[model samples]
Target: MDRIRKIFLVSINNIRKWATNPRIYVLFILITMFLWSSIRPILSFSKEMGIRVTPWVFPHLASSFVGQLILMLGVVLLFCDAPFIDEGQPYFLIRSGRYTWGMGQVFYIMMGMTIYLLIVNFISILILMPNIFLSTGWGKILGTLAENHGESVNEIEYISKKILLSYTPLKAFVLSFILEWCAGTALALLMFVINICLNRAAGATIASLIILLDYAIYSNFPSVKFFYFSPVSLSKLILIDSKGISNYPSNEYAYIFFIITIIVLSIISVLSVRRKDIQVQPAV
Candidate 1:
């Protein structure tokens, strides 16, 4: 219990800067930009048609094959500096040793990414709340857009019929949060492990590449066969077939994939802390 407490405290210390860092504003700005890109096309249509959407805009964005790419790209920009190495880290590492400190860093990444997602989700709800009323279902604008298959406007974002039928609005929001939180943690761990083994540039570059590949696969490949090659794609609930009848992966598959990836990466990170000569530097 004491060891766990220490690790929790260590994780808090690691993330404290993010709270104080002036760069936090950049994350807010990125959230706005990414959400705008996803919802902009439908915004005008909603206003013109006087559509009051439900407070379930998140799944609409997360379920979009392309919008998933944009949101994860925003994640990359926010947390690519995993292990968040700084001048103070060596002292902490020296005190806690490799295993304990590495666990702290891992916990920090998990908490950090979850908080980022929370902020993004909050902003998303606020955006919808202006004209939105409490509703437990997809409202008029989204229903019409889904019915028309998003051809009602030019390149609009949409929640597909499959997603609408498979999960209610509340379920969709919960699924989006959980899936995205897991995927973002995996991405942060990817950066931490690579940076520990190699360098920061390599870490950030590889993580960015994975997200770009997700976009490429959605844009060009358009097959569930390729989703395995891109970790970010695994987070998109839309691509995962709810009925188990489609070619896409199952929700169970996504949960298992994340569980396996996170466990493997967690083990590697803890083990490599002693052996890998990490000169991980801090970012502002």
Candidate 2:
């Protein structure tokens, strides 16, 4: 109990220290405000042009930007100055139970993302709320519903009933938040692992080269079937609709594969930390 409390406090303090830093806060606020501002013009343009863009798309874009920001932060705070721990010296996490510290870090990141997503979601909803309300007239609503229906039963009416029954925008936002966060965190952890494995400059260059090579291969190769599992590829789903992808996995399969990949990578990370020696540096 005492150990858990200590780990939690340490994690909280670490996050707070990062948050309170003037440069970090400035960067975060600027990026967030920029993204918030973008939603209005996008929504207005979509409305004027009669584009069928989802209200969720703005938040999804904001989430991806946030993911990139978090990745930068992780690189700065966790790996920038890490040094090899000598056998004679006791590493902080090794002494404090590495697993607890690692899990605490993941929780801290998730919390940060949750707060960011909430802010972005709020801004997006503010932009779309007026449209949703004013467009509630029978004709407008019917038109919207008509656009949604296929050759089968009406999608708009069915969705309207669900909405009337209290499936509010807040609920939808929260559901999207969970899915986006899962996808983001999993990709971030995997990136961290790769970064650790490739600590040198040459290795970083090779990683970049490999990324370009893979892009070419995936586009040109006839047999590269599992590109969807790649972080760069899968992350696109958050912004673009599933239908927009050239090779998107089926809805059910994507979720299953994503969850499994995340779980497996998370497990591998934990095992590496437990058994492998990491020359992790301190956040400057």
Number of the predicted model whose lDDT against the real structure is largest: 1
For each candidate, what is the lDDT? 0.78, 0.46
Candidate 1's residue-wise lDDT over 7-121, tens digit each? 8877999778776766767877877877766665566677788876676778768767666766777777766676677887888788877788889888888888888888888
Q: Once model 2 is optimally superposed onto the true structure by TM-score, how far is the C-alpha of residue 127 displaced, in angstroms?
A: 6.5
lDDT of 2 at 241: 33
Among all windows of 10 consecutive residues in model 2, the one with the lowest summed lDDT is: 150-159
Cα lDDT tens digits for candidate 2, 1-284: 97778557545655565554564555556655654554454445446556433454332342243333443343333322222222322444656676765555555445555555565556556666645433222233323433453112221122232222222334434544555565555545554455456553433343344334435645676653554544443433332234434444544555676688767866665565566567645333
By TM-score, how accurate is candidate 1? Answer: 0.91
Model 1 / residue 176 / CA error / Å: 1.9
